[model samples]
Each structure stands twice: as C-alpha cells, then as structure tokens.
Target: MSYSATDMIFDSEGYHQDFLIDLYEKLLKPRLVEEKMLILLRQGKVSKWFSGIGQEAIAVGVTSILQEDEYILPMHRNLGVFTTRNVPLHRLFSQWQGKINGFTKGRDRSFHFGTHEYKIIGMISHLGPQLGVADGIALAHKLQNEKKLTAVFSGEGGTSEGDFHEALNIAAVWDLPVLFCIENNAYGLSTPTSEQYRCEHLADRAKGYGMESHIIDGNNILEIHQKLSNIANDVRENPRPVLIEFKTFRMRGHEEASGTAYVPDEDLAHWRERDPIVRFEQHLLDRGILNWDWAEHIKCKIKQEIEAHLAIASEDRLPEFDETIELNDVFKVTENQYFEISGEISEIRFIDAISDALRLSMRKHPNLVLMGQDIAEYGGVFKITKGFVEEFGKDRVRNTPICESGIIEVAAGLSIKGMKAVVEMQFADFVSSGFNPIVNYLAKFHYRWGQNADVVIRMPCGAGVGAGPFHSQSNESWFTKVPGLKVVYPSNPVDAKALLIAAINDPNPVLYFEHKALYRTQRQEVPFDYYTTEIGKASLLKEGTILTIISYGAALQEALKIIEEEKIDYIDVLDLRTLQPLDTISIFASARKTGKVIILTEDSLFGSIASEISAQITENCFEFLDAPVIRVGSLETPIPFASILETNYLPYQRFREKLKELIEY
Candidate 1:
C-alpha cells in the first residue's frame, strides 16, 4: 500500500494530476496573501503580521482530508486551513485592518477569531492550551458515538509546555479521537529547537503516552495528504489519539516586527533552497501537470483577488467607542425550575451537601458531567464525589489527569457544545497552574465573542486545617478582579448546596470556593429538593443597627460566633455569597444603618477582598460613616503548617477585638 514520490506524480491511477495542480494553486493563495499583508504592514494599514510563508502546505494538506463537520483548533500561522474552510478573503483582510466587519469586530486584530458555523476554533496567544480543548471536543464526539475527529495544530515549542503533556496524557488515557499535529519549525520564537527540547523528534514523545506517532516531510504536500487521509480514517473508526510531526522551517521571523537577524544566514539559505512552494511548483512543471504560462496565470489571478478583497476590507468601518461598554450578560444565570421535596429536611455536613447537590443536578440534567482527579472511583480527595461512579457510571463521572490547566480547557470546550461541566480543583492553591485559561480565555470569551461557557470550577479554599501554604490558600481575590466571571463562596451548608445548583445552571463561568475548614465542621438543615439560590445575592444572616460586619466562607462562621457569643444585639452580619457581583444594595443599606462597618476574610491583608469592600463602603457610604471602615484579614505571611502559628495567623480573637473597637466608635 506504500507509494513513492514518483508513483504519486506519474501513476494516474493512484493520483490525479489535475487535483494536485488545483491544490498547488490553492496553497499559493495564502502565501501571496501573506506577502500582501507584509506590504500592508509597511503602509501602516495593518498593525502586525505573523507570517505562514513556509508552512502553507501542511495546513492545506491536513485540512483537505477533514470533513466539514470535523473541527480544527488552529494557531496564528495556519492561514491555509482558514482559506480551505471557506473563510472569505475580505473577512481575513478586514480582521487584519481591525474593521468592524472582521471576525472579532475590531476587538482583536490577529488570528484570534473563529465562527461556530465553520467548526474552527481561533486560538489565543497562549500556545498549548488548545490541545486540552481539542481533547474535550473529541471526548464529546466519543460520548455521542459520532465518527468525527478533532485536529489541533501547534509548533515544536508548544510541546515543551505542561499543558501539552497533560493534554496528551488525557487523550491517550481516555482513548479520544484527536490528531495532534506539530509543525517542527526548529524555533520557539527566538530559541532554537536544541535549547527548547532535548528529544530527538517531537513525535517520539508520543510513545510515553501510548499513542501512535508519525514524522513526515512537510514540504511534500502529496505525502502529507496521503498520510493524514489514512491516519484520520483510522482515528475516526477506532477512536484513539495520534501525533504527527511536520518537519518544516520558518522562512520569516516570528513576526514582521522581528527581522531575520537572529537566524543564521547558512540556515536560511539551506531552507530557501527547499522552499515548499517553489519545490511544489517545480514538481508540477516537471510532471506536465501545470505549464509555466498556466502557473503564472494562477498567481496573477490570486494576486488580483487579494487586491480586490483588500480594497473592500480597507473601507469597512471601525468599531465605535460607545460599543466598548462593559458586558454583564456573562454573569447572568438562568432560573431553573425548583422542585419541592415533602420529606424532612436533613442536617448534613458542607461537603456532603455539595455532593448531594451535584447528584441531584446530574439526575435532573442528563448533560451535566463531573470531572476531577480521583473523583471517579475514589470520589475525589475529600470524597465529595464518593459513590458517583457507581451511581452515574464512569462515562458521566470521570477522573482526569493531574492537570489544572487542562481541566479548565476541557470544561471550556464542553461548555461550547452546550454541556455543563463541574471541575474539582484538589486544592484552591493549585488554581494558579490553570490561572491563564480562567482569567484570559474563560473570563474573556463571553465579552469578546458572544460564547457562553456554562462551567463551574470548584475551588477548595481557606486555611483552618493547618495544611500549609500549598494546600491551604484563599484565592478568590484573583478571580474577583476579572470581569465576566462569577465568584461564589458560601458560609453554611444550605447556601453551599443551593449556590452550587445555581452555579451549574448558570450561563457563564463560576468559581465556587468551598472552605476546607467548613467542609465537615459546619452542619445545617439543607433542603433535599433541587433548588437554586440566586447568584449575585447576599444573605443577611443576622440584622442589627449597631456595627455592620461582612464576611464569607470560613471567616463568616467566626463572625457569626463572635456576634452571638458577645451578645451583640446591635451588630449586623452579612454573608456575601457572590464576590464579583457584590450585593451593594444590601451592603449599602446595612452600612447606612450602622454608620460603621468591618470586613473580614481569611486571605492575606494586602489586596484582599476585605480591602475592596472597605473601599466601596467609603466611596458610597462616606456621608453615613461615623468611623473609618476597618478590615480584618490573615497576616501577610503564607499559611504556616504549625497549628498554633496558623491559628495566630487568622485568630478569631483578633477579629473579635477589632469588631469591639468598631462597635464602640
């Protein structure tokens, strides 16, 4: 079944000469367009240009074998894939020009645009996160038993990223139908391949993950097409992952802004001699498939088309300043129908209540899925998902690799397909590993592009168990600063169960912070029925007129205990459930009534949630304030492992003393 280069060109029965000529012409278009973009770059019409001059053949050849229904998560250099996907020439030009008619509507000017209609995902600037997203898409297809595969493209440099390894491991373990193609251009920006990785070949790394691998000459389009065609078929049928490495070179620098000074002359000269476009053209001419005149005609026609599209796109209007208004739809949650339960209300621990909420949600919505490390059979590190695998099976309740970034990426992809995913972060501190996707992609997708990502990322936060810095950290402030994200932290079991139900049904991304200290400590009578507590709403735990005290998560428990133990009848307590969309109405009402306020949190004092609340109260309730607003937070040092040290770090006695001062003032 093997065919040589001569067999592909000369044997009419195996390969049609006309199809090769057409593909050659198609490949020429992206190169010409890229060259034209360089011209526009010099003329000050375009802001930046990331050239794909030397890698068009791989893009076109791989995309040619893909069906229209299949998806490709393409990077900035894969212009040929966009062209083959039927993306209009004028739209591409409009995007470069930052016009309103562009894919991002002038919000972004690079290749960060994708249409759901085209089944292509426009990549973010981050390199390897998309591989994990592709894994989720492939998982969706596998779950539905569809005969579709997902193709994700990256460079050899991306292979060095943690996300790359995590994604490959997940794909191999889950047997997902994904084609990971790496363009080995020998450089990651300015670093050479030798400095970037020590491996002999990028595809060789696939063996460690138990996946199939292939290495191909990128300049040979016929060979690439043939291999992809056969491999893609096998992947579609058998539902497993495959890795393909395309050995190519970058003729241009990373961008036009970065010239060829860093690259050696000898290397550039050697690669120029084997230019893919030139080599393909010579091959066509030698085989009599294309004449000199016909090739020239094709180039001229493509140039004219590029010019026409450029002219039209240049005249397209730019986005207005008024259109930059902040969008709040991403924080909006849908109201789910509440079902009543006649049975007696049961008092349960915070962790068990959360698990019951998840089980109820899964039973109500068939599309709801739970994914995390040790969450399947072992039922998570805290056993929040204990017995879920037995009840819902492995397909619905899944265990994932220890990849924080990959978990978020997969959840994002699942949300795109209208499925809800609940992600369990083993510890809140580990969220730093996945911070890029949560802040950049998941937080911005709804605002920039109108895509709703219905995902819940459960973060087990706060320090009361003496787990030390790595295991015990309250990281809610990191996400509260980000727009288009909902931050929820509950103080009691009732709100924990209700808010989790609401977060799962929400249309946007939600960061649900469950306090590790309160997981088994706090028990309350929780409703057994499926219900949703309103997001962006705070619960007024105790109402009073003296000093107003606001807190959330584990600290709220301390605040409540201090108020009752001290018999402070005039002090009010407010459990601020959602942080980002702060309950300003209730906060201001309490602040105005008390004329004094105190904010409490388990995070460090600097840049803490308490600081934000204090500032907002000073701004709006300044006239009503009789005393300066005060904030009580954990010490600036990391949470210590020693029980006494940790207790002193966030001592409830300090908070009690601070509240007495505010009340007396």
Candidate 2:
C-alpha cells in the first residue's frame, strides 16, 4: 500500500531542531555540488556528472539514518549518500576529476566505485544485478548472526530487470535483512513509467513475492528520513526483506550530455515547485528553526567548501599507469599450499575428485559457502552433493532458485566481504544465464576497484552424452577471451581436485570446466590426502621430437588412446591443464623441438581455444616449425542428437587423421 509520513507522529525520536538543520545541510550540499559539477562538465574539467539535483532527499534521508557499518549499494546519482556518510570531500572531488586519489585510481569514472572503508558498494551500469549483491551481503550478515541490514537502491526503470525479481524472491524466501529502495522519478532514460511497468507503484510489485512494501513522498526530506529510519531499524531487528518506493522526479537530464527534451515542460515545472531541498528549507522556516540569514549563510559555507575541494582536486595529477600497475591486481597471486599425499592411493573418478575438493575445502575454510539449484537435499542433478546439506547444514549448502545471475552476483558479494563461494551450474550450458554477472561484475571487479572476486563457477560441460544441444557444450573458449578470469579444463581426477582447491583459494573468479563425458569414463590413482595444483601450467604427457600434439580435457584422453593403439609414440603430447594464462613457456619449448604441432579439442573449430593455440604457436615458433600448425575440433553446425550424426559431428576420427598428417609433414 502507498505510505504517507506526513500524518505519522515521530514521538520519542522527535525531529529535533538540530536534526532538522542536519538533514537540511545533507540535502543542500549535494544540490550545490551537483550544480558546480554541471559547470565543470561544460568546461570539460569533469568528464561527466549524473545530476541528482531534484532527487537529493532520498540519498540523504536513507543514508543519514543507516548505521555507519551497514553497507549500502548506491546508484550513480547517489552523491548525497557519499556526502551524508561523511566520506572525505577531497577524495570525492578527486574521483570526479579522475585524479590518482580517486576510489578506483581512474580505472572507473563517475560514482562507479566501491570502498570497504565507507561501507559502500559501487553501482554497475546494469543496475539490476546489484540487487542480488545486496542479497549476498545480507545473507552473510544473517549467517554470521550479526544484527545488521544492507540497503540497496534502484530507479523505477531498474525494477523491470530480471535480477530485480530474482533478488526479491531469494531475499524474501531466505528472510534476509535488506532494504530494496526504489526512487520513482518516472523515467528510465527516455522511457516513461507507462512503458516501464503496468503496476501503479514499483513497491506494489512486492506483493506477488510476499514481501512487505511502502511508498513515501521521495521529495519530502522529513517523510523520507522518518519512514526510512523506522523501516531500516525494523528490517535489521526483524530479519526480513522489504521494499520502499520514494516518489521523486529528476529535475535535470539523465546525464548532462543527455538533454531532457523528451521530458515535458509541465512535468519539469511540477517537480521544481516540489524540489526536495526547497521544500525542506520551507519546512524549517515555517517551524522557526531556520532564518533567511542563517540559510544563505549555510548555502554560502557549503559553496565555499565544495569550491575549495574542487580546486585542490583539479590540481591533482591524473593516473600514470605502467605494465606492472595495469597487469597487477587482476588476480591475487597464490602460492602452492597443501599437504603431500602419501603411499596410500585411492582409485577415483573425475566426479570423485571434484567432490573431494569441495568436501575438503568446506571443512578447511569455515567461510566457504556453496550455492546451486538442487544442491541441498536433492544432492544436485548429478548427485555430486547428495550428502552435502546433511553435513554442512542448509546455511552453507544453499539450494538457490534457477536464478543464475543472482548466483554469480551473490557470490561476488561474499568474496568482496572476505569470504569464498563456489557456484555449481547444473549443466555447462546454463552458464549463459549467469554470463553478465560473471563477465561484467566478477571479471572486472578487481581490475576496476582492486576488489578480488573469489568465486569458482563449476561448469559441468562437454558433449558425447546425447544430452542434446542445450545440455552439452564445450564452450570454454567463451571465457578464454575475457581478462581477469582463470579458465581450467581438467582431463583427470588429480588435476580436477587440485585445481578446484586452488581455484577456491585464488582471489579471483575461476571457471572450472569438467567434461561430463569424462566424469565416470576413467579411473586413476589419486591422492588419499590433500594436495594443491599450480594454475597456468602445462604438463608433457608424452616426450618425443618427431611431432607435437597439444590438447586438453576429454580430447587429450582420446588422443592418448589413439596414439597408443596405433603405436605412434614418436609424437610429443602436451596437456594444458589451464586454458587461460596458458603455459606459453612449455608450449613454445615443445613446439620448437618437435617443429610440427597439432592443436585439438572438442569445441567448434572456428574461434575455439584450439584456434588460439594454433595462432600462438605459429606466431612464436614460425622459424622452428617445419610445417603449418593443424587444428582439429567439432564441426561448425549445431551438435546433433542422433548417434550417427553426433559421431560424424565430433572430431574423434578427424583428430587422429590430423595427427598422422602432421607427422608426415
């Protein structure tokens, strides 16, 4: 239902005169600073500014009431949120100027940066995914038994995103302490509310999800502060998610460059009369708490404060980066740390290795959490985690809805808060559902803000099980092209166990591709105890100088069998356990020695990891090569379902032929 704070009484915590003046200052500082930024934007001193001229009350009111340690994930227009939290003004000005002292060191622009010190999580341009991140931090707070809440904000337009629905559903189901705040300024860029949603108010959408929701006069500072303060306290103590819609209007364009030509002149006039700061100023003046002389004095003091900070920030040097500074912080360097397994060897399959790694990690690290679709009592679709929930309890072994985007975003929040999370995609193809969060949020987090996303996405991928097009895929190449991500495809159980354990410890996102076909196909003597494997390293499976065959995952196993069956032992075989940060040293060393190289995999030939390997070998080993590098992979067409068509579509026989052809050359 729509909520009005004008009729409510603020009995005990009555709005004191000082409290009124404090809120006034909070609202006025951002308004004046934003006006200054518009001028700077015109002069080209600031790259851009998301003017929150008319919407200052929401940020100030909500932020001023929140506990200093409670995290708030804000939008680009939340300049008042930062100012209300008492963050250094010079640093904020530095951030706007793209100086070296900015939160992201100029790696990001505008307010797109998070700071642990300020308890603020930055906004991603794709606004909705951040709601899922709120679920994660709130989940962490609940798991730790901490009486804290997380507040996340969005515009009326962002509520239409799938992540908004997914996050709301998950938070309500789990009863997480989160405040899903929406500032309904009536337009998403240029699309009006009539085009955005069918509901009367965005908070009304919460009813379908069984969540408590409220609406306030977003343009009224007293109403926003009182209602938000009461609701935030209630959510923190009661432990449930709630929705709050504050009705305000953006008095300026979305960005200074984007004019408000689409916004009707009458609408702008209507909102200006109800301007937040002006309304709050009149509220104090009518109560005799503020005088014109004192008010002009306050505005003048704030103006001088902003100008001084801006002048100092303008003189600051821009970021001067180098190869080391640019390359570093993508992923935290982890040393090989584990106990050596002794004489007793256990025969294990690929699936067992993955299970062993997770079981060991969950016990070793109390902060480690696992999230998947049916991972709790159902044991997952593959039954790999059948007994996990019983051991780790429902809190650690979380069975998430089929919301892949929420899974990645939530995992990123956990990692950012000094914890680790492992997400299991039932089938490798489902990674597509979570791709945006993985690539946009998790991948660029460390590079953009020096915040490592320690998330491991276990992709149960590959073909040959007759699972058809949707279930089967060898699409590791999709991630090999992205920076700040580590991709590892393991052929055997030993590597799978060690790599997964290493991935959990590595302070970055990792895609661990486990071929579905190889899960039960082979058994090997793996370690009975713990051990760690090095990432970005390759191993020589066969030593020879005649020809070199580079392959990984199920393809490498098939290649080994074919060569042994045909008595072709003169070829050198290299197994790349890690696809990203590829073992160039070993690859080039073997390529130069053998002269002829064959790169094979199960992925499609065009734009495959095999193609990348072929290009690298040719570029670096051209002088040593006696013949052109050969690449063998699946056909360009979609993977067929029929056994005969599937067999013909795969590269099993083609790879063997290519090996012999390279040998003869």
Report the C-alpha lDDT of model 2 over 493-514, residue by residue, as the tens digit. 8888888888888878999999
RMSD of 1: 2.6
Give candidate 1 misplaced runs (Cα > 4 Å): 1-13, 329-344
TM-scores, each model vs. reference: 0.96, 0.97
> Worst 10-residue stretch by lDDT in candidate 1?
1-10
For every candidate, C-alpha RMSD to the true structure in Å: 2.6, 1.9
- Candidate 1 local Cα displacement, residue 231, angstroms: 0.2
Error of 1 at 643 (Å): 2.0
